[model samples]
Target: MKEITPNNTNTTNNSKPMQQRKRKADTLGYDLNLATSSGGETAEKGGDGPQRRLWVKDRSKDWWDKYNSADCPDDEFRKAFQMGKQTFDTICDELSASVAKENTMLRDAVPVKQRVAVCIYRLATGESLRLVSKKFGLGISTCHKLVLEVCSAIKDVLMPKYLQWPNHESMSVISDEFETLSGIPNVVGSMHTTHIPIIAPKVNVAAYFNKRLTDKKQKTCYSVTIQGVVNANGVFTDVCIGWPGSMPDDQVLEKSALSQRADGGLLKGVWIVGGCGYPLTDWVLVPYSQPHLTWTQHAFNEKIDEILKVSKDAFSRLKGRWSCLQKRTEMKLQDLPVVLGACCVLHNICELRDEPVEPDLVNEVVDDDDDEMVVPEVALRSEFASKARDTMAHNLLHHNHAGTSIL
Candidate 1:
């Protein structure tokens, strides 16, 4: 058990610069007398642990050679992993151009392609910043800054261009989807409100949930309501995120910009289909769920189901049990719905271009006895639907059915 001690310096080699001083071999043992007498050095011994070598080193170049080979790296596979290849590359170029224009303030030492490649690599692979830095030969701070800046730029530059209906043609495509509901056959589309689960902000946790207290298990997480509408084909037409889940759907809807469409007499005679949550006005009601509701109702529901399924799978990274833990990161729960809208736009484009898949239908007969057990408001609303039934009945009996099927 010998204590480690600093080596003695030699001034005899003063002719050489201090920076050129060579380190000496280490000596082991407690006897200082023997150390001083025997040049403070010990014989090298072979052991199981890694050897402390003085000069030996490996300078292998084969790995680099292999990496450079065209066939070795599998560029096609790499391209596939990089989602939206051309689109992502375009954003990367845009970011570089923006940074270049700001060069009077600052300039980047890293190449634009490397910066773009690294940011997209981290996002697509979900790797840690430190790991990405090492892989990209970037400093940790640079890796973090580049990724954040690029993400912000990509969101700003791409969202308005790709995630929305830019013209009446796109709006018409969306409107066609909404018109698929049976009761509201002419209804352009339906709106549904969903939530992105979030941890209740510290002060609002207890008060955020409903007072009914029916089942705590079913209502554990706090969330924010995201209102969106999907067309008859199931493409999301409009999306508004950020309202707290504690708010009522109508309240959330009222605060939305889309609400102006309903209020400004924009939808007065125009056919807009929606669930029961929507009021019966100049717009149509899709019955949400009713027996007499058209087969289109089921078709629309099926589309919604597919969209949500794909969305959940696509952004599974944010699907946390609690909102607080999720919010602490760069991504927000509200962003999920925005991302979902983008996916819908992509889905619509894909559907329009791709050939259709053959269908498989399932048919089952319901018992007449099941009808008796249900109530009429539920039944009439199901069969003819409240909006269609009421509108037709009132028109025939009162106003001579002048505009019964205008939608």
Candidate 2:
């Protein structure tokens, strides 16, 4: 109050707070360099201010070194990649031709082996893209791009070689195997559909929702159904996927390319055994569902049940080997079919190579109860097909009772 000048008054007012801040900084052992560098004006500038230093250790070299080292054991490799070293090498060799590096000056592209390993590891283990990226020492975008690219490459190159429908000679051999196993003659393959859960789609969300039971908890989940045809040895011969979960199995079958092929008489002489969820047709045979069953129907159901186990086993081993299919996949709606098809291709490869399935995986069950049987909009049954079914059933029953003494 006694002759206080403007400059002196302002200095006195700021002195106490500055002293207090200096004392706090000293007591807290704060890095004076951080404050001194820009004088804390950046913090006052708010969200657009300079970012703090973030130290991220690059572990890509670690993964690359371990993968390339001779010390990495075969068991470790199998556990990480879900395939033996020989199988991995075989895949690498096969995919190398297709997924080879592109000549680009902008940073070297990932090597073929590393790219294939990333995709296979993601599919085999169903790990998140972030985790797979970390494990492979790649950026998340890099991992994502590589996975889809490799999946496309695999589907394009290997589908014909590995996941094709059996030829006439192969169909004969497969039919013989089916007859030996279940006494079902002329059975080219067994067909079944399983649901693969997915995230709620942005468009047509209701179409993808289906009731599912998990841990005995009944809940509506979004899923897509995969209808597969497998041989007697649990090897997939045909796969039709990307159908909505809300569609019945029969309806999905009716909309499938296989159905079109059958309709065009491409499958005239061949019969595929299916469950009760399918429509009875000359090319596709389903077991009887009525209560008062005849001996022929009973015998036919028994043999069809045995043959259908191949499809069940195929799906079980498929989801079991690639556990990703058992859970809700994080893939985009459009990209899911390709990934699912890639899994089937890999499953066929494993089966063809005689890779021993895990003992626990042998008994794994795949749930096919998503959709109930609905009478198709268009009548799928014909007298000719019904007569063929009845004739087959009768023949099976007669063959069984041929050596018996019927009084």
Best by lDDT: 2
| Model 2 stretches astray by more than 4 angstroms | 1-57, 61-64, 103-106, 212-216, 362-380, 401-407
lDDT of 1 by residue, 1-407 (tens): 22112342444544244223222211111111111112223323455433222221122324323433445444442332233444444555656764432222222255666666665555444566656655665555666667655555555665555445324565555444433323223445456655444555665565445322214335565655556665555445566776765665556666887777667765544444444444434453433344654444444444333333332322221121111212323344434444334333333433333312112100121111112111223222223344554554343334332223322
Clashes of each: 15, 0
- Write one digit per residue (lDDT tens) for candidate 2, span 13-39: 646665576567545433232221122
State each model's C-alpha RMSD to the native. 14.4, 10.6
lDDT, each prediction: 0.43, 0.76
Question: C-alpha displacement of 277 in model 1, angstroms?
Answer: 4.9
